[model samples]
Target chain A: MNLEILGYSFIQKGLIAGTAIAIICSLMGMFLVLRRYSLFGDALSHMAFGGISLGLFTGIYPLWTAFIVSVLGALGITKLRKSTKISGDAAIAVLLVSGLGIGVLLISATGGFKVDLFSFLFGSILLISTEDMLLILGISSGIIATLVALRKQLLHLTFDEEQAQVSGINTDKLNYVFVVLASITVITSMRLVGILLISALIVLPNITAIMFGKGFKKTIALSVSMSVISVVSGIILSYYLDLAPSGTIVMISVAMLVGTLLFKYVNVLGKSHVIQKLTSEA
Target chain B: MNVLEVSDVSIKYNGHLAVDKINFNVKEGDLLGIVGPNGAGKTTLFKAIIGLQNHSGKIKLFGYDEADYQPLLPLIGYVSQKVSFEPNFPATVSEVVSMGLIPEKKLRKGAVLLKNCGYSWNLLYKKVGKDSDKVLECLKTAGLESLKDRRIGDLSGGELQRVFIAKALVKDPVLLILDEPVTGVDADAQNKFYTVLRKINTENKITIVWSSHDLEAISKLANRVACMNRKLFFHGEKEEFFSNKELLKTYAESAMQMHMHDHN
Candidate 1:
């Protein structure tokens, strides 16, 4: 193992930012995927790209603009799905394409900094600065704290929304909170995983951990551990192999999901064989 | 005083009237069974009482105005008819029960609401299933104490229904609203479930309002009955519900209509 990379400040910053992102993504993503809103995160990430380009064009802070645009975009998606005849996935796709189109138009209008914009699209995890690190830490802490406080309510809502509302929970208001949190999670983690791959960080760890059949809290714990492992290992491998960190991280996540599926299959096969053997022996 | 009062309540969905000007009152400790054919708006009435649907008429809960019942929402527990989820929601029996005790706030108010629901400040910060007396009592009352650690998806239909009942009971609710509480349970299990509910009514004095298609079982248990088919056809004591020729005729005709509609 090339352990000497820890000496580099950029590596340290990348690790910190990656860890923060991994925690938030896994936690928030569990609820999203379970609610069948995985594409909502994807759409928000694309919208954040538009926000980033708008900020760059207007000469302001991109993260702030991305945060605002992503939140509004999420609300718009929610409203469109609720009010319009368009399907939920269709609504998401519409926003996704519009966002990408706007982002491209802005980039072309600016006519320079194509390299800088591409970094946001594909990510530049190794180039994380102290300011970026601080933003990640602050946003991650806020998201985690809010989730912890609303843990039981969120569980109730996720498990059975109608029951939650019937039990006097203000589900409409809670929904807004979920949208805002998801938007924040997508936008803040974009730098670590890139616009294209952010949803993978939010979704894959949760998909894998749910296969373990652990209870909700245990699933969340396992997902966070899995996400952090994939992120850290991917960063280290990328550093050594001179690969794209975002691509490497997403690939590692996909690998972990496949591994869990295979293990589940083998475990089922092993159990059935044991049962058959016992029956034959008897 | 009546535990619940619904006056001239009507519900419209997409310009179609589902429940029309229905009126009823439930006395405290009454096991009120609402019986109706399919699409007869029984569930809609329950939703109206739980404040889940918009209605034109007034609903009074324990003397609180309809709009003012938000603060008292914790006092009413509702079990849904449709138990739909991912089937991998990662929740245990006790965890689902704990959600009932989570208080209602406009946003992110789970902890604050839990504290207001009589949980001590210290207990609010602790992990779920810290063996609180209220949770244990509700579980024991609902016969789910033995399955507190069981994942919700792994439970049998009867046991799963009890878990939901336990979740509702944990709040010490004044009214327990159940929509088709025994839809998928076996016949034997349904009888046992009714027995448990009867005991809960007698021992805990929790007012129960349940919707069901099983008229015989409901008439056997419920002291009051509300018969409906898009409107209130009858509302009175169970004896009157059984003896009223006009009411019986209406129910029979509605049942025939439903059977024909299904075939068509």
Candidate 2:
């Protein structure tokens, strides 16, 4: 091993951002995915794509636009679901298409898809500036800390909204808080997988951790650990293999999910074999 | 004070009346068992009272505003008709019960990023175990102390039902609302469940509005009876509600019609 990549400033920044994002994504994504709202994150990221497009078109800081657009779009889903007869997933679909549509139109309006927008579409982990990474770090810390404080309420609402509400928890407020955190998570994850694959950060790690069938807190801990490892390993491998960081990160996370499922299958197989042998002997 | 006051409350589904002009009230310390057949709007009525379902008219809980249930939440604990969730979601029995004790007022705090900075972590994770005496006592009441550490998904339906009851009971609310809470429970457990309910109603004076299909349980346990078939068919003393053969016959026929309509 050359061990030379560790000295690079970009690699250090990527590592810091990757680890922070992994923790926040796993924490918030667990709640969203479990509630069947994982796709809501995907849709919000699309909305962020539109924001990024608008920023690139207007010559403004795209992160600010992405933050504003995605947060507003995320809240729109909640409001639409609450105020109308439409389902949450249906509301998400409306935003997803509208975001993607507006994004393409904006790119065309700005004289077609520019190279600047593609970096955000596919992520540019190696190209992170000090300013960008600092903002990401600040927002990521805020999201993680907020998640920690609202931990039990999130789980309570996730488990049973009616029970939580009757217990005197204002569930709608917790829901808004959850969506805002999820939106911010999508916004900061731009440098990791950009707009297209951002939900992977939230969903893949959680599915992998859920395979272990651990209890609630343990399941979250396992997800964060898995996500951090995948990100760290992906970045290191991308450096040595000359691969795309965003693609590499998502591929590694999916590979972990497969690996966990395989492990559980083999464990079940081994237990069954032992039982078969015992019955034969009897 | 009346623990719950429902006046001229009506609920509609797709422009058809589900609960029409239902009027009733429960004084503090009263244990009211509401019994009605399928599609009789018992569940709908409960949902309206809790502000879950949209309805017309007024529902005043603990002297709070009509229809708005936020302030009354701290004083109320409820078990909905559908008491379940994502099976694989990681929640333990004790943790589920401890959720009830998370002060309703504390939970109503702002959800802004830095607004809940003073939120206590210990109140959530540390106390969410067998360590909390209230959780243990509630679990004990439900005969589920041994299952406190088990994953809720790993439990039987009956056990899961008790876990929810423990969650509802852990807070010791002024008003306890349960809708068919003992559906999957065995007879012995059901007997014990009612016994605990009776004790709480008499000793703690926790006003209860329990809806059930089991007329036997309601007849034995309820001091007040309410029979519904899309409307308030009867709301008075249990003896008056049960002894009136003409009223019972009318409700029975309406229930049969509703049951047949459901099948159709």
Candidate 3:
């Protein structure tokens, strides 16, 4: 309610970055969720933790290392799933566990969970540096642009991968590109909700949107709106309540999901109940 | 005119030969039914033809060589076995069918895409109006015009098959390849599906090379039949395939083996 909060540059940056990442993650999440890789963001974010730890241990920029490790890790998961011998679910679990395992080991090596580790683990969106803001803006735009460009191909591939390939799509390349983009989205989203809960930002709104039983594009539209609303409101509330921005954002997302589910089932139950009563009267 | 030519095609799958040294040619407008029991490599052969699986062979489409099936893709429409995607994929019938046009529009008419929308995804969404009539025509052919706006998941297996068939037809492809499309469909849906398949073959004159478990359906529709159990059993006139008692026995044996495997 305080208009004075808008005057703080850090608050403005956090809100902008949060909204941007939400849009990117929600859009990316829609495609992944449809493809049945709903936890891919979660897996990649865990790898990003390991990636950041490696960066910190090696004295490299943590975000750059996070990007590198996450991309490679995502590609590995994709390759594993494609091999047929290894199931996609197993591949996801492997990467998810490996990332967290390595991250923990490296954290211990770095002499426990310091302020740096905690900052990335839970995020510091409210204190986003200008460079981080620029990075978020750049990454968000690039991701959105690429997704829109490949929309049809992605749609066809998502709907039916074999059919997409037979359509002369270099599906292999497209898939790799897709995973890379997903990795970028996961890594970029880390600043918003950190490694621990970035997947919530990526997947929650999309899941909620699906509960509406809308078409794919409509689902995406609904998801984006829900995500933006959650991010914007979560940020404002976080400022006023003196809570963590990331937790507030994800909490709002969880609230939206529960609310949508309630509305959906109640409407369904009400309709079916009416039908049952009418039949009994007849 | 040979619509499809496969020479010395062989596939090594899971450390064994799934399809071995297969050779066949499908002439223009020919309805060729590929029949085999489960694991007979009928699906494998289809996958090879459609470039889904790796194989060592020579494949020519429209007289063009293999490894460059890129140019020939727009001329071919492929529907794989069982589809088996998440039932909740969220694509409506029309949106999926409209996607069939993307390969054609991207491959054959690049300039139209450039002019319409710089970003091809926007172009697809924007060009939906332009392709609506065409999408409907394909749907009509598949008897799915009624389900145009329905979410594909809401449809039954038969209806879903028809949706994919409709999606394939949106390209107005010269070659239509379907793998076990009517399997798991009920008798009534099967009949309706056959009716659409017959219309496309006889009226539209689309060259179809399909793999199916239904030999009876193949006998009724396909002019040519290829019976296989890894290696080609017979590739000739449908009458020859049916009338040969010895060959029929071998085919029956493979079918029997499939049943055994299923039970196991």
Candidate 4:
């Protein structure tokens, strides 16, 4: 591909926006994986659709509306997890379905909407604007700053809530904060990957990182790197192949996960002899 | 003075009473053992004392009722029954130990708190940073110094239990509460763990309360025993409770059966 094709202002904005979303989602994905709340990402992404529809109905900025709605969904999930006997997965399912249902109703009520909902469903790189790129950057920076400030508390809480509480961490508050951050990341990433595929950006890279990374910090770094590679590659492939960016990105992430798994398997097989010898000695 | 006093405390879960009308007092240097069946209220009682569960009646820690003595939490160290840490959580054994020091906020500089807990400086340095000396001492005390750099998720069941103990001990708590501290450990590790507990209790004069299903082990280690099965079935000296055949039959029938089966 020529530099002009890649360097077009619109394409450049799309790439920047995609990169920012990739970083935020990957970093936040680590926490979601650790806390075993990966599905919460999916739930909030769907819930953001409702917020987007509501924003359209109210003539408000959909991004801000989506952010607020996602936060509300996050808070709802947190509250439901604590106050009810429902499992996290069950709660997520309920919230996801209800939000999607509300979103469909609201979108139907809007007559001759300018933006096609299908574009947001599978994502449209062509829709990237300067404003959207700036929003992505802002959300990315916010996630990084919040994670840094609460790194210690988050680490402790993720490991053991009872211990964290005993150690003077306000676990209840931190839980809300973590989920809220996750909601915001979902909203931001939805612009690039769409509601249907956003969670892949949040889950796939983190899972791949977990298989190979040594520790928490390394896992996060590796996840971000993998996300960046996948998103950038996916965008290029989408452009050349005339495919949806969302589908391409998710497929690439899945491929990377499979590659990482195979690599781990081969490494484990190579180390089996040493492990067997050690076990026999023991 | 009694460091902890509980009166008519009851805890319910989803309409089922896990602990009903339990009462006890813990004094300085006291080793109180709580024993019961799987569904018994032993663990629930510990949770209630730590303010992890809402319950009826009153719990006084350091002479203040639990409701009003939120500040007293810093003086108490708790080790839960289940060690369900995030498997991929990024924390070394030393960092896990330092979690116990959180309540203290600002630990005294160059203090031997970690040393007393059993971690050394070298192991601490390998885990987080130079400031992890206290954490290393805690690991050493818990007999996990060599594994200081190891992530918490990689630890064995027995090793993880000890890590929690080390975390608790690093606080130099006035009272230490452990829930089923040796549920999955081998017999040998269990004995060693009890020895460590006894040593800590004797040497530091720290009051200790631990729950276990092993009546024989409880008899050996605990100076006082509290039998809880949704309520206080019995609470007194270990020998006295053991010698009371009727009370032992009612309080620890399963443990007694296991004891007889072992002898046979």
Instruction: List the DockQ of the predictions in order.
Output: 0.56, 0.52, 0.56, 0.41
Off by over 4 Å in 2: A278-282, B53-58, B62-70, B104-131, B184-199, B202-205
Please write out the lDDT profile of model 3 over residues A1-282, one tens digit for every residue. Answer: 657988899989988998899899999999899888888888999999999999999899999999999899999888877876687778889999999998889988988887888889998888789989998999999999999999998988998887888887788899999999999998888888888998898789988988777788898899999999999899899888999989999999999999888988899999999999999999
Per-chain TM-score of chain B, candidate 4? 0.83
- The DockQ value obtained for model 3 is 0.56
Model 3: lDDT of residue B7:
95
- Sort all candidates by TM-score, best to worst: 1, 3, 2, 4
Model 1: how far is A76 from its true place, Å?
A: 1.8
User: Where in model 1 is the C-alpha error above 4 Å?
Assistant: B104-132
In model 3, the Cα lDDT at residue B111 comes to 37
Residue-level lDDT of model 4, residues B1-264, one tens digit each, is 577899988889868988888889987678999887667777777777877788899998656655556755755778888877667676678777876665234333212433443333222222444446767766776778998878777877888888888888776676889899888789888887887788777765678999988888888888999887677778889888899999877765766665676678
Considering only N, C-alpha and C atoms within 3 Å, which residue pairs clash in candidate 2?
Answer: none
CA-based DockQ, model 4: 0.41
RMSD of each: 4.2, 5.4, 4.8, 5.4
CAPRI-style grade of the A/B interface in model 2: medium
True contacts kept of each: 0.72, 0.66, 0.62, 0.44
lDDT of each: 0.84, 0.81, 0.85, 0.79
Clashes of each: 1, 0, 0, 10
Categorize the docking of model 1: medium
- Greater TM-score among 2 and 3 belongs to 3
Tens digits of per-residue lDDT, candidate 3, B137-208, equal 788878888888898788988888888888887766768999999887899999988899999889877889
Poorest stretch of ten by lDDT in candidate 3 chain A: A80-89
Q: What is the lDDT, from 0 to 100, of the residue B55 in candidate 1? A: 88
Instruction: Please provide TM-scores computed only on chain A for all of the candidate models, following their numbering.
Output: 0.95, 0.97, 0.96, 0.90
